[model samples]
Target: MRGAFSTNKTMGEAPEMFYVNGFAKVVPEVQPNHVNNVDDSSTWYEEIIDDDLKWSFKLNSVLHKAISEYQDIALLDTKRFGKALMLDGKMQSSEADEFIYHECLIHPSLLCHSNPKTVFIMGGGEGSAAREALKHKSMEKVVMCDIDKEVVDFCRKYLVANKEAFADKKLDLVINCAKAELEKRKEKFDIIVGDLADPLEDGPCYQLYTKSFYEKVVKPKLTENGIFVTQAGPAGIFSHKEVFTSIHNTIKQVFKYVVAYGTHVPSFADSWGWVMASDQPILIDAVEMDKRIEERIKGKLLYLDGAWFHSSTIMNKAVSKSLKNETHVYTEDNARFIPGHGIACRP
Candidate 1:
C-alpha cells in the first residue's frame, strides 16, 4: 500500500512536518501480497453518478489497469459484482447485472424493426451487445466497433459471462473509431446500437453523442426503416437529468420519432435511461411486441419479456417534465464534460 504524509505549520518558528504513513486514519492499515487483496480488509472501486450520489463495490483483486492508446482500462475482480470493467475510472459493466443493460439496449430497437439483418454496435467491447443481437435469428451480421482494443482483449480473457460472444462467427470485431469507419462504408444497417460510455469531454465518446455525428455519420448508415438507440445515462429524477434530456433531444433532431425509456440495473444503482429513434414507428403495443420477440428472437431472456417490455418503456413523470424544460442540445462546439466522483480504498 502507498503512504501519504501531512505537516502541521507553526506560527514563527520552523514549520513541523509529519508523515501519516500507511492507508490513513480512516482506512485500516493492512498490507496484502497483491494490490487487489481480498480479505477482511479490501480496496474499493467507487464511481460518482452525480454531485451528491456515488456507488462503490469491494474489489477482491485488480486483474489489470493500463493506459490504453485512447483511454485508461481497468479490470477488477469484485466481491458482489464478480469481474468488472472500468474505463477511465467510470464503471462500464459488471458481471452481476450487465444483461439488464445489454438486453434493454439491443432488443427494443431490433424487435421494433420488422426484420433487422445487419447490426452495428458502438463501444460495447465486452461483446454482450453482439451476443444479444445474435439471439435474433434474422440478424445475419453484427459489427462491433470500439475505440479501445485493450478493453476488448481484457474482457475476452477475464469477463466470464459473455466471453464466448467474442468468438461468434457473425461478429466482426473492429478496433477503430466507429463513426469514422461507418462513414466510409456504403453498407447500411437495420439496427444501430450505441452502447457507449458517458460523454466526458476528453473521452472518445463525447463527439459521438453530438448532433452532428448522428446527423452526418450515423443517419447515412441507417436503412430507411432503421432504428437507432444509445445509452442516455442515469434517468432517476434526482440523477443526471441534463445528460438524459440532452441525449433524447439530440436524437430527436435527426429522427422523425423519438422515445426515451428507463430500466433499473442493480449494478448501476439507478434507473438508467436509453433513447430510441426512427423515421418509422416503434411498436408501443406491449402484446404485439411480445409476440414478435417470441417468434423472431431465439434463446431464453432474463429481464426482457412481454411484461418487462411494457413496464420498462414507460417514462417517469418527473423525467418527462425534465425533458420538456431542457433545451440544451449536445453539439461538438458546446459539449459539456462531467467528471466522475472520487474512489476510496477502505479497510
Candidate 2:
C-alpha cells in the first residue's frame, strides 16, 4: 500500500448469522459505551489538504483506534463536534452534522428518478446512506456492499445514530468488494450510489471512479433509466482542481447527462462535491423535486429540498469553468486523489 487513504462515509455494522467473508474466526468486540473522555494519547488531530495547507480539530479523547486489514480506524470524542469517525487518519463524519453530507449525497438522485425502488450503494459502511434510502416509501431493497468488514462492524457498534438503519430489513449488507458484488449480480437497480471513499494512490477505491468502470461495470448494472451518483471529493475554489473536476469529466464520458453539486461540510473542514449522472434526462425543477420528496420519502429533511437542490447545482464561477475546461479522465493509471490524511497531534 502507498499510504492510508481517507474516505467520506463508508462505515457500518456486524451482521448476525451472516457469512462475513475472510473471517475464519470471529473477533472479540469492545463495548463502545465504555470509551471515556479522560483517557487518550492525543488531544488534537490534523487533516492535511496538501503539503502547505491543513485543518485541525480539538478532541476530548481518542475513543477507539486500531489498524484493520484494510486501513487505520479511529473513533473520537471531539470537543465540539460530538463523536467523530476517522479512517486512515482522516475524519469521515461527525455526529453533530453528518446529516448535511448524507442528505446531499443521497436524496437528489433518488428524487430525480420518478420512483427509485431498488438501489445499490458501493461503500456507505456507516449505514447513513442506507438510513436515508430506507426513508423513501418507494424503496424495495437497498444493497450496501463494502470491502471492509472491520470498519463496518466498528461503525455498527459505535455509531449509535444509525443503529436502527443497520437493523432495518430493507438494507442488504454484503461483505465484498463492490465491483465483484456488482458484477456478479444479475439484477439491475433504479439507482446505483457510489457512496465511496475518496481515491488515493494505490488504494482499491479509485478504479470505481474511472471512465472504463462507468462504461463497463456500473452502467450495465443500472436499469434503462437508472441514475449513477458518486462523491466527487473536494470542490472548493482552492481544491476543486484535485479530484472533483476529473471525476465529473470521467462520468461525463459515459453518461449523456451529468450534474455536479457541492456543499460545505463542517467536519470535513472544506467544501465537498458529488456528481450525479445518467443516460436519461435528470430533470431539475425545484417544484417537482419537492413534490417527490414529500410524496416518496418519510420524515422531514434537515437539508436538501427542491429550492436548495436548485441552488446547489449552480456551481461557483471558478468550479464551473474548471469543469468545462478539465481534461483529466479518472483512470487506474491516470487518476487524481484528494491530497491529505489525518495526523495525530504531537506535544
Candidate 3:
C-alpha cells in the first residue's frame, strides 16, 4: 500500500486517540497538555493533537529519520487525528490524504467536468486519491507522483485501511518530485489533482504553487477540457483575500474558469484549501453529483456525501466573509495557517 495518513477542535466530546509508530511507539508532544508532538516520522506540519477529545495531550515524537529507521505498526490514537492508526515505516500520509483530502479535492472537479476519464495526481504519496478515482467506472487511469518514498513505506507497514487504495491496479505510482514528473508528461490528463503542501521558497515542491510554474509547468499538461484541482491553503486562517484572489486570478490567465472549494478537517482547523480550475464553464449540480458518489462509494462512512459538498460551499463562504481585503496569500512559503489569522482556507 502507499501509506497511512486529525484533529481536536469541535464542540462535541472528542474521541480517545493516540499517535504512534506502526510498532506502537508513542509519538512525542508539542505542548504536552493541549497538544503533543509526535516523533518526526512524516514531513508535513508539527504539533498534531487529539484535538477532538477532552484528553490533554496526544502525538508521536518520532523524529524525521531516514526510511530505514521506522519499525513496527500499531494503532496509537483514533481520537486525535481521526486516523485509526499511526505508522512509522514509510512516513508519508499520501494514502490517507487521498481518501480524506483527495476525495474532497478531486470529486468537485469531476463533478464540474463534462467528461473526466484520465487523471493525474501530483504529490499523492499514499495513493488514497488514486483509490478514490478508481471508483469511477468511466475512469481509465490515475497517475500519482510524490517525492518521498519513505512515507509510502511506513504507511504500507502501519495503516491497513489504506492498503486497498494504495494497491489499486489502475494507479501508476511515481516516486519522484511532482513538478519533475509533470514536466516529463505532456497534455496527458483530463483532470489534474494537486495535493501538494504550501510551496517552500527552497525545496523540490516550491514550483507546484507558483504563478510562473502553473503557467509553464502545470498548464501544458492538461487536455483542452481538463480541470485542475488543488489544495489551496487553510481557508479558515488564511482568508488571504489577495492569495485567494491571486490564485483565482492566476489560474484565470490560462483557464477560462477558476474557483475554490472548502472541506473542514478538524486536524487543520485553519489550514485547509482546495482550488478547482478549468478551461470550460463549470457548474456543480449537487443532486446529480451526490447520487453519482453514493452509487460509486462501496463501504460505510461517518462523513462525506452530498450534504458534505453543500457544507463545503458554506464553509468557503464563511471563510471568505472572515477574510479582510488587505490579506496576503498564505502559501507554504509562509508558516502553517494559524487559527485566529482569518486565513483558514480548508477546502
Error of 2 at 19 (Å): 39
Error of 3 at 275 (Å): 0.8
Which digits, one per residue and each the tens of the lDDT, describe model 1 over residues 1-347?
11235543544433233323211112333344535333344466655555676566776778987766676677878889888878766777888888889888999898889889999999899888999999999889999999888888888888776766787888999988998889888899999999998876567688899999999999889999999999998887677465888888888888999888888887777778899999988865778778888898887788887677767767778877888777788898987555552122212
Off by over 4 Å in 2: 1-42, 341-347
What C-alpha lDDT values do all the predictions have?
A: 0.78, 0.82, 0.55
TM-score of each: 0.86, 0.86, 0.67
Model 1, stretches more than 4 Å misplaced? 1-39, 341-347
Superior by TM-score: candidate 1 or candidate 3 = 1
Candidate 3 structure lDDT: 0.55
RMSD of each: 7.0, 10.5, 9.6
Which candidate model has the greater TM-score, 1 or 2? 1
Q: In model 3, what lDDT does residue 53 have?
A: 18
For residue 306, model 1's alpha carbon misses the true position, in angstroms, by 2.9
lDDT per residue, candidate 3, 137-246, as tens digits? 67878888877677666556665665886787777888877778889875578888887644322223434666667777778888888888887655554444424444
The 10-residue segment with the lowest total lDDT in model 2: 15-24
